[model samples]
Target: MKNISKIFMFLLIIAIPQIAFAESSKIGVVDLQKVLNESAKGKEAVKLLEVEFEKKKKELDIKENDIKKLEEEISKRGSLWSEKVKQEKEEDYDKKVKDYRRLQTDLKDEFQRKNKNFTDKILSDIIELVRTVGDEEKFSLIMEKQNAIFTSSTIDITDKVIKLYNGKEKGEK
Candidate 1:
């Protein structure tokens, strides 16, 4: 009788972990990149950025044209110009080119900084929404789909997250 009780105790101990695991909340996956691409706010943000970039590109093109014309004029009058005057003109052109390059660099840096900030803000909001959904759905863990090679549809929460995010953005509860 004592041997039977000991055997039962060992079996119970082994079964406890399996039972706990079976009852535990499941891990869910979300494709964050897909969410961002499909979200309405994300699409709008992308369009705005593209427009701003195009404007800056146009401005740069104008500056480039001006520099090219200056160089052409200088070359055309080279035969009639004094060596010192030619050197001065070349120096002025070089300075303008340098300044334009600096401006280009600054613009690029500013664009990158702004883009990063914008994306970070959006991602933060999305993360909050994801957390809320996970909590409501009793998810034990929520992983990014990008990190996972495969996940069952039962555990995929991408659409739910996107819907929640967009709904919040639209002032929907």
Candidate 2:
């Protein structure tokens, strides 16, 4: 009977660890890039940026046309004009060209700034939504999808994040 009791105790010790390992931690992942691309708020922000881009492009186009016309005028009539007059026209054209280039640079910088601001805001909103989902679902860990090389499809919560982001956007409006 003592031998039987010792055998049962050994079996119980082995099974105890197995039972502890049976309960798994709930982990979730979110694809932030996909959320930014697929979400409605992201799309709207893109559209607004595009509109601003087109507007700047048109202004640049008009300035470019003006430059081309000035160059053509100099080519056609520069030889007949006084040296002083030709020099002045050349200076004017140079200044205009410089201004156009500067404006182009400024527009690009502005666009980048605006894009960063938009992304920062959106990313924060996503983080908030992720936290909410994690809390509600009782997830033990929520990781960025890009960080994981191998995750089950069941653990991917990017779609859930996008859905929540869009819903939150709607509520704000």
Best by TM-score: 1
Q: In terms of lDDT, which candidate is strongest?
A: 2
Query: Model 1 off-target regions past 4 Å?
Result: 1-15, 74-80
Candidate 2 stretches greater than 4 Å from native? 1-22
Backbone clash tally (model 1): 0
Q: Across residues 1-173, which tens digit of lDDT does each residue of candidate 1 receive? A: 99999999999999999899878957999888888888977887788888888898899889888889879978999668999989998998898799889879988998898788778888888888889888888888999987888889988888988887888888953
How far out, in Å, is residue 78 in model 2? 3.0
Instruction: Write the residue-wise lDDT of candidate 2 on 4-95 in tens digits.
Output: 99999999999988777656568899999999989998898889999989989899999999999999999999999999999999999999
- Looking at candidate 1, what is the lDDT of residue 48? 84
RMSD of 1: 3.4
Cα lDDT, model 2, residue 53: 93
Deviation from native of the Cα of residue 48 in model 1, angstroms: 2.2
Collision count for each candidate, in order: 0, 0
